[model samples]
Target: MTYTSLMFALFCLVLLLVYYVVPKKFQWIVLLIGSVAFYLCSGVKYILYVVITAFTTYITAMLAHKNKREFSEKLPQLKETLSADELHAAVKKNERKSRAFMLCAVAVDLGILIVLKYLDFVLSNINTFLPEGSALPLFSFVLPLGLSFYTFSAVGYVVDVNRGKYEPERNFAKFFLYLTYFPQIIQGPIPRFEQLAPQLFGEHKAEYKNLRNGYQLVLWGLFKKMVIADSVAAIVGAMLKNTSVLSGLELWLGMFVWGIQLYADFSGGIDVSRGVSQMFGITLDINFKRPYFALNLTDYWNRWHISLGNWLKDYFFYPVAFSKGYAKINKYTKKKFGKFFAKTVPVGILSLILFTIIGIWHGANWGEVLFGVFNGVVILISTLCEPLFVKIRKRLHMEERVFFRIFRSVRTFLIITIARVISLPSNIAIAGSMLLTMFGIRSSGTSFFAFTGQMVQAGDLKMYLPALFGCILLFVVSFLEEKGNSVRDMINAKPMFVRVAIASVGTVIIILFGAYGIGYVASNFIYSNY
Candidate 1:
């Protein structure tokens, strides 16, 4: 169930009550049941997908572990007498089983993901070269929510188990809770087994602190999502749907608003997820910081979707850069081109490939593919030119000045906006046209005043004002949050009565003014589609 929904909120409250009342040892069972109930509420069919994935990985890891033990037992006689070379062979044999297990897990998870998420796109492409009458019929498939997220987590767990980084979970129910935790089922910061497994199996008694802090976080996230994102979404949706009729200023405004909407929508989801988990005395990973305040693309990524970026770095970039072929190329470049160029070239190539994968991971569409390539190019160019830029700054003696820093920040934001525009477009052609229009090389009669008038005529002005105000409020709050001030801590530091009053008012505001179950219940977060 979606964390933002009333159904989920009520469900969590009931689960929380039952959890604390149950015996300490049975807490995991309570959680397992709750998770199952949560997924079943989504529909029984979706639960099958979750169960199939959980059991498949569980069985594979068990077999892999068994194989390793058997091999170790067989080599016990030689362990005390064998030479280093013989021991190496035995180790290699054991590693092969682990590798095979990981391969199977990856194959199954990716196979399901592709069939469920991209089969239609594939069939449509195939039909392009065939006769009109021979076109393939499209069939509908209901993708299980958070399949992309949980699949990655499941694969990461099995790979970690194979690598001996974490032991395979022996209890089926505990493992199931890890995969289908209600808070993270809809969207995720993609928890690792090492991070989440202990909590799943631990005895978690409810705390007053957890309740207060968790509710505060949930309320704050609601403010961002309903007050800020929903309002901006109204404008962004209108502009995008009628982009052909928009002018340059109107288009840019819409793009800017879209950027805000995306940040609020995605980060709001993270906050709500974290808060819900917190209520259960579980701490999930922090997924966002004040990314817009970042001084460069690299900084932006570090603050935004911190989990996914780290995963890509660890799983994709590191392997590519450290591969034998990559090392050989690096050594060759160092010998032929000199040390300075060699040091940077390999990493740049690896970064490009990783970012491209990042783009494709978002979707199978050409727009996403191009978006990934666009980000990769931006990051690579920034990396390559960084030293040059630093050198120029040093020569000008502007490195330490506030003005230079501000200038650098502005440049970074613009680059990020351009990259995100490419990422968010419906198709490659529209993205290309937008880029052309952005560069002012194409003449388009899209005017800001005209679009503003159109928006007012369409009854968007009333909602737009509060959303704009909310955006400003969010920025101020985020600025404080970035400075390391905790909003919850600030509220708690006040008198108890004050805290209660603030929370009560926040709840009332959310109920009266929140976007859901009113004019915008049909709208979902942008990333939910991914």
Candidate 2:
């Protein structure tokens, strides 16, 4: 069930009531049932997919944990009975067995994801090179909801066990709960087993403060999604669908609006997820960190999707950058060129590779691949020119000024907005054409105001004022957050009458301004596709 729907709101309210009334010890069981029921609502067949992932990770991690325990018990016996070389060989053999188990688990988990998500994309591409009569038939497999997210979580869990990061869970139900937590399973911060497991299993009696804060955040998230994101989506949809009839100014406006739509939709979803979990007294990791305030592309990435950034750094970047192959390259470059070159080249290569993987993870399309590569290229170019930038800044003594920092942030935002086009359209060619039209180099001769007038006649004129008000609300909240102020806490600190007044006004705004109801078509959260 989508978080934005009225049905989902009623579901949460009922679940919260039952959750609190249950005996304290059975709260976790209540969650397990609720989670499974939630998935079943999507489709009975979909539950099978998540079960496969959860079961595979559970069995493999237990096996690895058992092997490690056995090996440790036998090590002392082997040391007493054998020479140093024999002991070393015995240990190596056991390590090989453990590694094989870990690899098999990872392959099965990721293999399922690959076949369901990318197999069709792969087959369609292969057919392009084949004779018409010899083309392969495409398979129509329905991808399970949040397949990428839960698969990655499971794979990371088993791998971490192999690396001796944490002991595996002995209880199967608890372990499965870690993988299937409903709020995060839909779109995630992709919690590590160690971080999320305890919270899932422990009892949490509903507290008044927790309830108040949780509902507050959920309402705030609704404001961002329904009032701002869905409202702007109408204009963005109209402009993008009729780019051939829009002026250069209108095209640029559409692009800017799309960026806002995407941010509101994705981050707003996360806020709702976190708020729901918070009601149960479980605190999920923070995913966004005031990304718009970042002064560089790297800084923006660090803030934008904090969980994914940390995931890549831990799983992909550090391993590839520090691998033996890169180690050799590092030494050779340092000896032949200079320290600066040695330090930058290896990291730059791995950073590019990481972005490519990130892009492909979004979808099985060439546009996403190019989108990833484009981001990598920009990041690498900036890194390579840092010396020149530093030299210019030093000469002008402009680096430390407040105005200069603001300019840097604006520059980075524009660069990211341009890069957003790759994934905005169905194909790369359309995105490229849109960019050309946006620059006034290739207009279709339609007046900008005429297209906007069409929007009015189509009953979308009512959305504009609400969109503007919502955007201003977003800016104010984001600015306060950027300055290290907690807007939620500030609200909570007000007088009782004031708090009620604020909540009443916010709810009224959403009821009147929201874009979903009987006549309006409710849209799925955008990141739900990923």
Best by lDDT: 2
> lDDT tens digits, residues 83-136, model 1?
889889878977887789878977888788888888988888899989979999
Best by TM-score: 2
Q: What RMSD does each model have against the real structure?
A: 2.2, 1.9
TM-score of 1: 0.94
lDDT of 2 by residue, 335-392 (tens): 9989998888778878898889888887899888887888888898899999999999
**What TM-score, to 2 decimals, does candidate 2 have?**
0.96
lDDT of model 2 at position 123: 98
Supply the global lDDT for candidate 1. Answer: 0.79
Flag regions of model 2 displaced more than 4 Å: 446-459
Whole-model Cα lDDT of every candidate shown, in order: 0.79, 0.83
- Per-model TM against the reference: 0.94, 0.96
